[model samples]
Target: MRKWFIERAPDRDVLLKSRWLAPVASRLAPATIWQFNRRSIARGLALGLFVGFILPIGQIILAVLFAASIRANILIASAATLITNPLTFPPIYYAAYRTGTFLLDLVGGARAAQTIAAAQPTGIWTSLSATSLSTFVGLLVFATLSSILAFAAVHLAWRVSLIWRWRRRGGTDRAVTRPTIHQEPPSV
Candidate 1:
């Protein structure tokens, strides 16, 4: 499954040579960031998830930098940030805003709730009014939770895959190695 997925993913060389990334090719060590491993992949995923939610633009650039700094897989980090792409961004941000508003209201009482309700945000880039504050706080919370969950999920999936492969091969190996009694055919 992993091999299949990797095969279908964008090639490291192709991405590096692309016009948009060619200028920064010197800074990107494809080998270091492209290799697949448990630690690197998990860290990359976490970094991607966190950055994806926090920054709507330049997510790939930020992910690559973060992955390189943390010795994680840059490709994975860049790809993982797609979680907040156009198709899913609205819902995620809305949920984050709602969550932030709820928490603020819970902690700050009706006055805070009323304040947040009064400010109608035209978009994500609006001023830091009550509504925006709650939205920001909620985004932070959601990013944190998503990062942690993504890391854990990757680790869990890796472990499970390893165990499954081991069990499968173990059974086959035993079957192949087990002695099979043979008797000469009765003399005819």
Candidate 2:
């Protein structure tokens, strides 16, 4: 029964693995990320870090999907790490930590600060200070966001390019064969 289900249902690994994904992914049509030009895709991946940092949630999942769809190398997809490098890690995390703390405090009332510190004792004591928490959270958030965005952007560019190529080819064919309805009929 378990084997049957494994074969019938979309397993998590199967869904996650790009090669295995081809069959189901085919439904994505001409917009597939797999169809993208390699150099362009690589460049796009490199540039996506900027967008990733600004995006909300850990949207790097989208980046992975995009990379898979575009068939761009996973290395390029993971390159959003450029934004979270050693130099920037401290500042970004510090900002996120402060933002999260401030936001939490605003919602949790005047006692929010003391309560959070107390509740997540180890995290607070070891790493959640305004000075440290930002770095920690920044690292976490940057990793999460970049991965998601790179995948998404790569996939999006691939899909658009595929559709555009198809349309362009299709248009040229149509134009070449199109007949003029306004033309006079041939005489016998």
Candidate 3:
């Protein structure tokens, strides 16, 4: 899985040559931000998840900025931010709106809930209205929780993989190093 991910991920050269990223190339310290360590990868995933959930536009840039600020893996951050792509956007946003509305109704009362329900968000532009405070709150909650989960998951996976490899190697080494009978000469 790790090898597959590494093979499929965009290398530094590809990212550097990207026309969309050229403007910010100077600002990004590629080596520092692209290193693949537990902390960097976990943080990058978290940042990417957070930005991906909150903003529809400029997600890549936001992920890059967040990754750069925290010295996380830039490639992973950029890739992970694709969580909110076209196919997944509507459902995620709708769920967020519903979650927000529910929370607001619970906290504020029926009036606030009615207001959010009354404002029909036909498009992305209309969705950002101040009238729909529930949507914003819901997004914030979703983003925060998603980021935290992503970070923990990455960290846990890394640790589990390391342990699995270590245990497998220990068993394999014992079997390989075991003494064998010297009966080849008799057979010949």
Candidate 4:
């Protein structure tokens, strides 16, 4: 699984050459940022999911920056932001707005929100203050929960994969190598 991805990912130089990535090329030089380890990939996925869920714009750019700062897998971070692409955007935003409305209503802010929305007409891309705020709150909640869930899922999957591979090779006992202690000296 790992090898398949490593084979398909763009080279460091290739990414550096792209105009969009050129400005931050200096920060991308660290080998650790591109590593395929469980921790890095998990962090990358979490970051991507968080940004993707929270922000309507600049998801990839933001994910890249976050991934670089956290030393996550950049490719994974970039790819994970696809969770909020065109096909999925409507449902996600609609759900987020509804969730925010419910939470606000539960906390006694629904009247104020409804009054504000009713007072003004909102465009497709832009909305009144109250509506936007509700959506933002909902997005924040979604982003936090989803990121946490994604991180845990990645780690769990990786653990399962490792156990499966070990079992396939032989058994759990064979997967571990205990350190050997020198009990006696051997004569040559």
Q: Ranking under lDDT, best-scoring first?
A: 4, 1, 3, 2
Give the per-residue Cα lDDT of candidate 4 at 5.
89
> Which is the better candidate, 1 or 3, if ranked by lDDT?
1
lDDT of 2: 0.53
lDDT of 4: 0.86
Tens-place lDDT per residue, model 3, 79-166, is 8889989999889888888888787777875465456546775655544564357667788899999989989999899999999989
Better of 2 and 4 by TM-score: 4
Candidate 4 off by > 4 Å? 115-127, 172-188
lDDT of 4 by residue, 1-188 (tens): 67998999989887888898778888887888899999999999999999899888999998998899999999999999999999999898888888888889889786776676667776553355667777787888999999999999999999999888877877546547533475455569
Where does candidate 4 clash, by residue pair? none
Q: Give candidate 4's TM-score.
A: 0.81
- Residue-wise lDDT of candidate 1 within 1-188, one digit each (tens)? 56876888788777778888777776675576777889889999999989988888999898998888888998789988899888998898889888987887788853555655557645444434656677788989988999999899999999999999899989999988776778455588
Name the top TM-score candidate.
4
Better of 2 and 4 by lDDT: 4
Each model's TM-score? 0.78, 0.44, 0.77, 0.81
For residues 15-103, write the lDDT of model 2, one tens digit per residue: 44577556555533333343235454554464346334544445455555555554553334445535655687557766776665565
